[model samples]
Structure formats: structure tokens, C-alpha cells
Target: MSRWFRVGALASVAFVLVVLGAALRPLVLPEAHTAASILNAVEIGFAQDMAAHHQQALIMVQRLDRGVDPTVLRLAQQLSDAQRIEIGTMLGWLRLADASPLSAHPMAWMHTDAATSQHHSNTSHANSDAMPGMATTAELDALAAARGHNAETLFLQLMFRHHQGGLAMARVADELLTSGPVKETARSMFQSQSQEAGVISVLLTQLGGQAPH
Candidate 1:
């Protein structure tokens, strides 16, 4: 065979091997299982809403990426990474269950009469645009423009409230979601966010700033 032809044949063979290797690669997907009877429509709804809730927390931490305070910047980076991964996990659950992330209203899943009885009596508001622990666009804008200690203070305060809000949702998920994966996730959220909240509280005190009310 001609040298040029031999080289072309080898190149074709290599290309085919690469294509077959890619085709045979395993697709890593979230596992799915049958939902417990207690994990009814409400549980699914709660998971969907909470996933959206976590997304806002993720957004808030991302804002601190541009911040100037070393401590605040570090916390923000850590929070963002952690929540981003959780958000993905929750989103995978929603997809597996054929649930929608964009719910009709924020916290709608926890709006049932029975669930509401478990908490203080208050009128529920239906705001699809709002997440439980989210900073307002105005507040976010201010944080983005701030520098130095002021930025650190604001980031901590916002994050403190953010974690509190997440804990509330996590608590609800713990009480409501009954399936194995759902319960496991809710419990994990409760534990992780609760721990992070404590860390933030200490940092707030160290920074000479009060935690959010």
C-alpha cells in the first residue's frame, strides 16, 4: 500500500474507535423510585417549591463573588458552590418525578390547611416571583455596588436571613416529604443549612454585626 493511503486508513480507524468509545460511555442520571403514599401530590409540590427556594439562595451567594471583604467573599464562594450542587440534586428529583420547578406560587405546597395548622396563623401571600429567603433586587444591586466592610456586613446579614428562610423550608420538607430519597434530601438540607447558619452567626458576631432578626 502507498504510504499516504496507509496513513489515511490508520486515521480512519482511530476516528472510529473514538466514536465507539463515546457512544458506549455510561449516562450518569439521578436514580428514581416509587413514592410512598404519604409522598403524595403535596410532597412533590413541596420539593418543587423548595428547589426554587434553593435557587435564590444560590443567586444571593453568587453576588458575593464580586465582593471585597475576604471573609465574606470566601463564605459566599463556599455557599454558592454548596447550594449549586444541592440545587442540581433537587432539580434531578423534580425531573424524575415529572414535577415543575416553576410553581403557581412560592410556598404553595406548604399552604394546605393541615400544614398551615402546624405553624403560626398568618395569611399566605401568593407571589410566584418571590423566593422565601431571597434579597430584593434593590438589595442585591446595593450589595453589588458596595465595597470593604460594608459589603461584608450586608452579605452576612442577607445570608443570615437567607439561611433562616432555607431552614424553614427544610423543616417543612422534613415533616412532609415521606419517600426515601425525598426524606433523605430534606434531612440533609436541614442538617447542612443549620450548620452553615451557625457558622454565619459566629462570623456576624466577629464582624461586629448583629445577625438578622
Candidate 2:
């Protein structure tokens, strides 16, 4: 597609971020301590990391070819739109918690594995680009340069793997968070991404492309 479409989508996303910020401002208590107490490290970290993860999905969408099959384009658009709104929501939560939107230790909040702390310690310096389901700079570059059926197959494959990784984090969040808006959101993400991943798999198969390992 033309650069104009990408610019317009980004512009819309910025407006959404503004609206979400406004809506969440009232949720912050006058006392920063109270706000901090309400949101624990796990909640804050999940929001931070997931927002970054969702941003990548938008990048993939923006990089997609303009002349791909309508089915692929429509799915990409729908997923991107949903994830963009989710990114706004997550950033709003970070604002309420007075936490940085960027995670210093990506995936460190996940305590599912016994070696999680050790994993964080070992990978701390390089964790920024190491989040689950994140595309490498090379992979994104390839996606940006690809066109037509090649782009469609690659997008579906990459996105399928991306969704799998995201769903893993969501499941962990849902398991760890007892009750709260974040947990509810995590559960919602898990459900939605699961369904979306299944559709992506079907589409990838129809395109004669195997899901990436």
C-alpha cells in the first residue's frame, strides 16, 4: 500500500492513545503510593511488555503488501486494529501505575518456570529484543521487502508464531494474577488470540505454507 495508508493508521493510533490516557487519568489516585500499591510488579511488567509486543503486530500489518489476497489483508487489518486498541489500553494501565511503559527486564515478570529468575539473570543485558514472539530486525526487514503470495505466507507464518508466544504470556498472566482488570484483560487476550491463531493456521494451510517452527 501507499505510505499514506500507513501514516493514517499511525495517526489514528495516536488519537486512540490520547483518548485512553484521558479516560485512565481519573483512575490514578492522588497518592502515588496508593497507585503503586494497587499495581504490583507483575501487573506493571505485563502491561509494559505486552504493549511492546502488540506494537510489533502493528509493524507487521504496516509492512504487509498492498496487493495480497483480500482474506489475508482483511485478517491483518482486523488483527492490527484490535491490537492497536489493546496497546492503548496497556499504556493507560502503565500511566495509572506510574510505571515506565518500556520494560527494563522483558519477560522477567513471568514466574511460571522455576528457572525464570536465573533466566532473567543470564539474559538481562540482552532482554530488550528477547521477548516471546518478537520478530527480529532481520525478520521484519524481510517482511517489509516481500510482496504478494510470499508476503502473505510469511506474514501468516510469522504472525502465527507471534500469537503463540503472546498467548503463552497471556496464559501466564492469567494464572499468576488472582483478580483484577489486568487478569481479565489477559484472559480476554488468551481467548481472542487463541481463536485468531487457529484461523491463521487454517489460512496458512490454504496458502500451502507451513507454520514456522
**By lDDT, who's the top model here?**
2
Best by TM-score: 2
lDDT of 1 by residue, 1-213 (tens): 699999999999999998887776545443376555534566677677777767766766666646366766777888888878877877777777676766766566676666555323222224433455667889988877777777788888888888876776677667776657777887888899889989989988998999877
Global lDDT of each model?
0.72, 0.85
What's the distance in Å from true for residue 203, model 2?
Answer: 0.4
Model 1: number of backbone collisions: 0
lDDT per residue, candidate 2, 11-73, as tens digits?
A: 999999999988887785353453337588889988998999999999999999989999999
- Those runs of model 1 whose alpha carbons end farther than 4 Å from true positions after fitting are 1-39, 65-67, 118-131
TM-score of each: 0.72, 0.77
lDDT, residue 200, candidate 1: 88
